[model samples]
Target: MVIEENECILLQHRTDEDNWCIPGGVMEIGETFEETVKRETFEETGLEVNGLELFGIYSGESCFVQ
Candidate 1:
């Protein structure tokens, strides 16, 4: 998820892949969704965020592969 403020958003650039994308990663065992978001955002962007709300949850056949 990208944090938006004043119509601007935060993104991370992947030097290995040479692409820009939202900062995120797989959730660790025993970590809540919010905790995962905060940890990934900090790891990728060096920024700390708080007061997060659940945005949306996506899951379906189209989101995965057989």
Candidate 2:
């Protein structure tokens, strides 16, 4: 879910966690799954309601988030 804006890809810098993810995080309890994707993108990269286009959905048990 990387947002290609200008020249740089939108990445998150979490002070308490990983510093570079494509603006996403864990789902809050009872919240919609898409809510996690949308909300996390905003909270991390500070972009909201722009031109978000879905490229793909990723799933795995390994790698960075694992």
Candidate 3:
């Protein structure tokens, strides 16, 4: 997440779920992780992001989160 100097984080509101959340989406074919992050972030928030640190990777059939 992008944290400003004031320590406020950037989050997106999900209209369908009626809640606030960290913006993310499924990766596209042939896209690098960085490319996916940049594309998804801009698509969700209309903000461009550069220099992302590798965070946790999670996967499993039961890994669903809301």
Candidate 4:
């Protein structure tokens, strides 16, 4: 999830589910990890990304969230 310049987290309203969620989707073929995030973010929020930094990577997670 990304925090916008206005201090608001970029969230998309899914029409099917009507739930708030950060811009995210499955990565496409031959795309780098950073490219995936950037692509997904823009696709969902219509925001052009300048850069992104990875804080951590979780593997084999058993629901780190909820």
Per-candidate TM equals 0.82, 0.54, 0.79, 0.70
Candidate 2 Cα errors over 4 Å, as ranges: 28-34, 60-66
Alpha carbon deviation, residue 25, candidate 2 (Å): 1.7
User: In each prediction, how many residue pairs overlap at the backbone (N, C-alpha, C within less than 3 A)?
Assistant: 0, 0, 0, 0
- TM-score: which candidate is best? 1
The TM-score of candidate 3 is: 0.79
* Candidate 3 C-alpha error for residue 14, in Å: 0.6
TM-score of 1: 0.82
Per-residue accuracy of model 1 over 1-66 as CA lDDT, tens digit each = 779889998988899999999887777779989998999999989999997878886657765634
For lDDT, candidate 2 versus 3, the one ahead is: 3
Candidate 1: residue 19 lDDT (0-100): 98
lDDT of 2: 0.67
Instruction: Give the Å error, residue 48, model 2.
Output: 0.8
**lDDT for each residue of candidate 3 in 3-64, tens digit (9 for 90 to 100):** 24377788889999999988888777899888988999899999988868877665676766
Q: Residue 19 error for model 2, in Å?
A: 3.2
Q: What is the lDDT of residue 62 in candidate 3?
A: 75
Task: Find the number of clashing residue pairs for candidate 3.
Answer: 0
Q: What ranking emerges by TM-score with the best candidate at the front? A: 1, 3, 4, 2
Per-candidate Cα RMSD to the true structure, in Å, reads 2.7, 3.5, 2.9, 4.0
Root mean square deviation (Cα) for candidate 2: 3.5
lDDT of each: 0.85, 0.67, 0.79, 0.73
**Top lDDT hit:** 1
